[model samples]
Target: MLSNTTPSGRDVLLPMFFIGLMFFILGFVTWLNGSLIPFLKIVCELSNFQALWVAFAFYIAYTVMALPSAAILARTGYKRGMTIALGVMAMGALLFIPAARTGLYPIFLIALFTLASGMTLMQTAINPYIVCIGPRESAALRISIMGLFNKGAGIVVPLVFTALILSGMEHVSEASLGALDAAAREAMRNDLSQRLVFPYAVMAGALLLFMGLIHVSSLREPVLDAADAPADAAPRQGLLQHPQLVLGAITLFGYVGVEVIAGDTIALYGHQLGVAHYGVLTSYTMGFMVLGYALGVLLIPRWLSQRAALAWSAGSGLLFALGVALGSSGESTWSQALLGWAGVPAVPDTVLCLALLGLSNALVWPAVWPLALEGLGKHTAAGSALLIMAISGGALLPMLYGHLADVSGPQRAYWVLLPWYALILFYALAGSRLRRWSVA
Candidate 1:
């Protein structure tokens, strides 16, 4: 049985490499929203709520486009859909050039929507591809490898944006702006805004170039089929009956919601604690998450099973969130140590909480997929799209948290993540079971 169950390791590597490249782009774009939030607020003069629409615009694209992407994949196959996603990302990046020139936040959001819509296409295509590329026992391991590229990008995105934006902001302090005449201030804003031009232009060029590479690449196009057709058939029909898929969608929804909240809200949390330079809080939070991802690369399927890793992570996240809530309530020293150690320049405690949240978040996506897609052969593509659509939780939940923050304060609003982590814990337990409802 062991001999018969061996993985086709070599056959899966090259395709996985290209798939990992797409995941890298996903992480880079998603995590860069951290920088975009503050950058847009300064450049476009947006309120906190308005700036957060950066996340809303980008993640909501998944909800709007997932079904459409699935349809395209159903018709066109994975390789072509990936190529189209790349092309669309290029278009989205190009829109930034003009939006930057005019200092128009709404146009920037439109550009984000285009970019996210493209990612919606890419995610819808690639997730199932990762699962299908290997034996069931090692599917999570392969996806974890895919995630190393994804999280590796997360690690770098903020540093890149910091190099781009922080230095520019140094030129526009209160004193500098105060000294400038009205016209000069306007000129300064325009000049600072234009800094976005070159970065986005380069991103557009890379995206377009990747599109060409994908167009000519030899990646296989996996397709959805009836469950009984072949051992490797994509489960098209029994998907409706699959308990794991249903529960996994809920799990993904909760994971993205909390993950977004942890990363996106921490900067504001730092500000509430009277921490200056809250602008960079998001980057530090990603560092925490990347640390966890690094561990995932080293340990998954070696010293840890994905389910075991997820359960442990989720439990730790719940504990960390509790610590954050307590620290925010006036226990500043503990919170300071938590946040500061992660290199966040603000109230160190808040940064620490956010970083610890990253450890909890680490195994979520990689763990959730294999459990969800365990037996989904023909239905893997559609099921994965449903799971992708659930990512709209990131778009909607943060907006809800924003409203709560406005009314209650950023720290108080963290109460929401308690239940979010609870749901994640549920999935790690019985929710991951493949046939929770079946008579079999």
Candidate 2:
């Protein structure tokens, strides 16, 4: 039984490298929104509520384009679909060149939506590919490692955005803007927006280069065979009978909502507290997320079951959410408790708690995918798209949090995260196990 369930070690070697590369660049692009939330708030002169539409525009594309992406994948196959997706992303990157020059918020949004559309397609293709490529027992670990590539954005994205864009600004603070008269403010906004041009130009070039590399590369589509199919469901029927898929989508909806709130909002949270260099604060969250994924990589299946890992993640999320809402607003003593010796900037206890949400969020995605997609068989592609559509949680939830922040204060807005984590916890303990709406 052990021999039958485990795959040869060499089978996963090739797919892992290329897919890991894809996930890394994908993460590099996605987490830039964290830095961008604050950066764009400055450049576009947006209110906190209005500024979070950056996240709304980027993530909503996943919901909006996911089904179409699946259809394209069916016709074009995964390899061609990935290449096409990258090319679309390249075009989206180029759009930033003009949006930045004009200093228009709407154009930046269009650029984000376009970029996310490509990612929607890429995500629809890659997620199931990764899951099916390895032994079922170790799928979470494989996906966890893939997650490290994505979460790596925590470290790399901020430095790139801050050094490239923020470096051009003489002073980047609300207090400095308050001192400016109308004309200077407009001039300053235009100057700050234009600095985005070079970085986006470089991103477009890198995207196109990767597109070509994928077009010529050796990444083969993984074959999904009888051995990989789950016994629980018929392959060709509609997914209505699969409560796991439905509940899984709901789980992801809340999970992505909390995840985005944690990753994207930290910089803005720091900005509200008037922390120096608040734009880099998202990296702290990403750093913790990377740590969580590292643990997932090591302990999953071998030392931890997927269910146990997810249960721990959801519970910690609740604790961290509490910390964010009610923790001290004072100095930096506890910051050392997390990873202080590494030179992560000291933040208020409340904000550090928010960053620690990354640790809580890290395993939810890795654990949820396999549980949801198990036994999906021919519906795997469709199941993947449904899960991808769940990404809209990031799109809608943050806008509501932003509105709440506008009405209440930023710290008060964190109360919104509590219920979502609770819902995710429910899924971990019991929701993922239900097969039918009616009790047996």
Candidate 3:
């Protein structure tokens, strides 16, 4: 049941506004990795495998800090936890100054870890709060609405990074670096790395301001009671006994992995395919995500339930993943047909298929959260933490893709996403419904 004190209709607007802002913050910081990957590859003189540790260090923090976030939210409440998270994130943003000054890859990874730790806190607090606030049936719908705010920022973060950092900077490939002497290469790297100092400074200040704003806001802590519990709720021995939530976490693991690949690696692959505007490639994926969220907002619960939407998303992911793995590397009619007349440059068929994964992935996170926690009752907090921890998929899978790219090539590396989508397709079809580990 929905909490009595939680807002409804117009009353819901204020709380949603604050949560939506946090989601925007999440998207902005997270999606920047796509641009940063190619940029840092230049600055740090790293291989594809080494560069993807950018994602690894960032997302691994969720697994490390999610349970701690639950404990902190238990005491400080959601509003205070979010405030603390922003302050922590601001500190991490300020850390970028030194990282830029020295141009040390390890320091940059440390900064990213700090930022993700804070983001983990924010996500742990907000996801359950959003789910438990409204009618249970519409929880997926509510999350999809939040997805608009989250992915809406994804659509712009890379473009902003490009305009601020990549523009006017001399582009260098690992291939081109061989021509430059050591001193000259070091000088160029220092100059390129220094560009980050100003933007991260600005980001730190914004995070501090947002922290203060959240501290002063009137957001309510979510009140989860027995009303939210399902009748078949199991004993609290361990959350592992619950199959729906566990399977959902696994589903998220795969979902976020492929989703990260789609959103973050498109630029690298585009650059490899000789696309000129590769830096802004993440925007294509995010744009498709925004469109998918809009469709979810309109159609969910009204015309389609969350489970059905997940099925469709998974199927689309399978088709698109195959396209990415096997489709033409040459420029295709897809981008021209879809975005050409809009004055947008056309990308290769393979890159377009990779971008389409964002559409297939848009709804999985929102739909999985509600379905996973459905019967948890008193254990919902722990369940949410577990789901949040599963974001390590984003860390691990991309590293795998990067390694595969190095050994074989970036194009064939997309084959890694096939099994991931297949796992999610399994969950949407059958796994989300299981209560115990049995065949029931």
**Over the stretch 1-440, how does candidate 1's per-residue lDDT look in tens digits?**
11233436655777888998999998888888876776676666655677789889999999999878988876677789899999999999999999999998889999999999999999987887777666666666777777778777877876777787666464444446668788987887788889889999999999999899999988766533354112223454556688888888888888898899888777556655645565566766676777777788788788988888889888998998887766644445764555558654435664577667977897798888888877765566677778899899899888887778778877777777888788888888888885758665
Backbone clashes in candidate 1 total 15
Residues 234-307, model 2: lDDT tens digits: 34346657778888999999899999999999988888787777778888889899999999998999999998
Q: Model 3, range 59-144, lDDT digits (tens) per residue?
A: 99999998888888877877899999999999899999999999999999999999999999999988888887777789888899
Model 3 clashing-pair count: 0
lDDT of each: 0.77, 0.86, 0.89
How many clashes show up per model? 15, 0, 0
Return the lDDT, model 2, position 39: 84
Please list the residue runs of candidate 2 whose C-alpha ends up more than 4 Å from where it truly belongs after superposition: 1-8, 168-170, 226-237
Give me the candidate number with maximum lDDT.
3
Of 1 and 2, the candidate ahead on TM-score is 2
lDDT winner between candidates 2 and 3:
3
